[model samples]
Target: MELRKSGSAVWSPASDWRRGSTVRWLLLSVGLGWISLFDSTLWSQTKEVVLPRGTDVSVMKKDILLFEKILDVKLSHIPNAMLAVVDRTKGVYLKGYGIVLTFLVNINRVVITTPFGERPVGKRQTAEEKRRRIHEIREMLIQALKDNPGSFKQLTPSDAVVIVAHFEDSNELDDAKRHKTIVLKVFKRDLDVYKTNGYEKFKQQVVIDEY
Candidate 1:
C-alpha cells in the first residue's frame, strides 16, 4: 500500500510514524482495483472506520485514533454501576460500502442508574421513558461529536456517522446485544456543520434517528 501525508506527499513509515504505534493500513491489492479483502477478524477489528474510495491511509488512521480518543474522553463516565461505549466501537456495512460508522454505547445500567434511581428500562420501557433515554443518549453523542473536524475528514459526503446505545444487562448477553437500544445517524456533510457553523447550529442540524 502507498501512504500519503495530508499534503499528498508520499509517506515513509520510518520517516513519518512515531514510536509505540501499530499500522493496520488498508491493504491495496495490485490489479484488484480498490477492493478491500476482509474476513471476520478484520471486519471485527476495522468496523469502527468506514472508509471511502481514495481514502488517505495516513490521515484516516490518525484521524480515526483521534475520534476514538474523543469517544474515550467524552463518554468516560460511570453512573451507578457504569455508562460507557461497551469495550470498543462497532459498526455495520450498509447496502453500499464504506458509508457508515455505528458506535455502541452501553446504556443498560446508564438508564437505570439515574439521578432519581434505577428507573426500569428495556422491555418495560414506557413511551416517555424510551423517549427520555433516546434523547439523553443522542444529546450525549452530540457532545461527543463536538469540535472535531478531523473525525469527519476521511468520510465522504455520502458517508455517515452512526451511534448505537445498547441497553445491555450486567450478566445477560442477549438483552445486552438485542433487547433495547437506540441508533442515531447523520451524514458527514451534515456533521461538518460544526466546522463552519457553531455548536448550537450544528447540534440542531444533526438529525437524531430513533434516539
Candidate 2:
C-alpha cells in the first residue's frame, strides 16, 4: 500500500484487493455549472448512467501489513479485516472503504487499534484494562447479534455490504507480550429484515425493488 503524509495524500484501494491493499477512495463529482468557477467546465459533458439496483457487488480479500516505520517498534504484526464493495445505481459515482486493526505492547502499555471507523482507546492502559475493553467490544457484537441475526451492522463506513473480519493475538510473556486470544465473526445483510426495519426504525425505507 502507498503511504504518505496525512493531508498530502489520499488513500485509494488497488485495482484489485487480492494482492493486499488497505487504501480506499472517496470521490466527489461536481456539477457542470460549478466547473467554470474552479477553472474549466470539466464535467459539462458528463452524463449519468442508470443500472438496476443491487445488481453490482464484488468480493474483496486481502492480508494485513505491519508498518515498522510508522509504529517505531522492534516487531510488528498486523491483523486483517474483511473488505467488500457494493455498487448503488441511484448516484453516478463509486466509493470504496477498507478496515484494519492491530495490537501492540510496549514497555509502558498495551494498545489495540481498529480502523473500522471506531476510535482506539487513548491513555496508557494496563494489559488487563486492554483485555477488558476487548471483552466489552465483544459484548457489543453479541448485542448486535441479538438485535438481528444474519444481518450486518455497518460497524464502519469502510465495511461495505455485510462485514467480514477476524483478529488474533498471542502474547503470553509479560515483556512485550500482552494478549493471547483469537476472535472472528462475519455477517451479511438480511435484506428481508433490513427492508422491513429500514422503514419503521431507521425512518428511511430501502426500496428492495430498486436493488
Candidate 3:
C-alpha cells in the first residue's frame, strides 16, 4: 500500500521567508523614536549649591553678582548657613526654596528658620527642632572660632573660600554644571589658586577642622 510521504520530506521555503525580519527593525526604530522624543527637562524646581571647599570667596562673590546680573535678580540676606532668594523684581518669596537663617554675633546662638531638606543637628522634636539645629550649627562654629582664634588663619593663604549659588531654574536643572562650564572659561585665574593651594589641603581642612 502506498503511504503518504513524511511531511519532513516536503520542500520548505527559505529561512528568511519563514519569519519577518522587519519586526526587529520596527522595534528598533520605535525605540529610537521614543528616545528622541523623550524630554530632558529637570525634575526639581530649585537647585541647592553648597559650593565646593576650594571656591574662592571673593571670586565667588563676583560670580554671584554676575549670575544675578545675567538673571536680572537681586539676592539679599546672604548667610553662611543658608540663603533664600528674594527677587527684586517680584516681592514675594517662594517658601520651598528660601532659607531661614539666624545670624550669630559675639559667639551667642541665634535661632533661624530651617528650610526643607536640611539635616537636623539634634533631636528634632517639633517644627522648632530644625531652627534649633541651625542655631546649634552656628553656635558650634562660633565656639570653634573662640577655642582657636587662629582657626581662620589655618586656611592656607591660598585655600579657597566656599560660596553658594542659587539659580531661578525651578526644575533644579544642572544649571551649576552649565554655569561652571561657562564661568570657568571666564574665571580661569581662580583655577591657578586651586593648583597652587591644592584641593587636597582644602578638603583635609574641611574634614579635620585643624586649621
Per-residue lDDT of 105 in model 2:
23
lDDT of each: 0.57, 0.31, 0.31
**Model 1 lowest lDDT segment of ten:** 19-28
Q: What is the lDDT of candidate 2?
A: 0.31
Candidate 1 structure quality by residue, lDDT tens digits, 1-211: 5666667566677655633233323233332433344455577888878765676667766666666666656556533223435665544444333334445555444245668887654444344654565566567777776666557676777677666655544534564333465565667777665656766777776666551
Q: For every model shown, what is its TM-score relative to the native structure?
A: 0.49, 0.23, 0.18
Off by over 4 Å in 3: 1-18, 39-56, 59-211
In terms of lDDT, the best-performing candidate is 1
Q: State residue 27's C-alpha deviation in candidate 1, in Å.
A: 49
Root-mean-square deviation of every model: 23.6, 28.9, 22.0
TM-score top scorer = 1
Off by over 4 Å in 2: 1-55, 58-124, 144-176, 179-181, 186-211
> What ranking emerges by TM-score with the best candidate at the front?
1, 2, 3
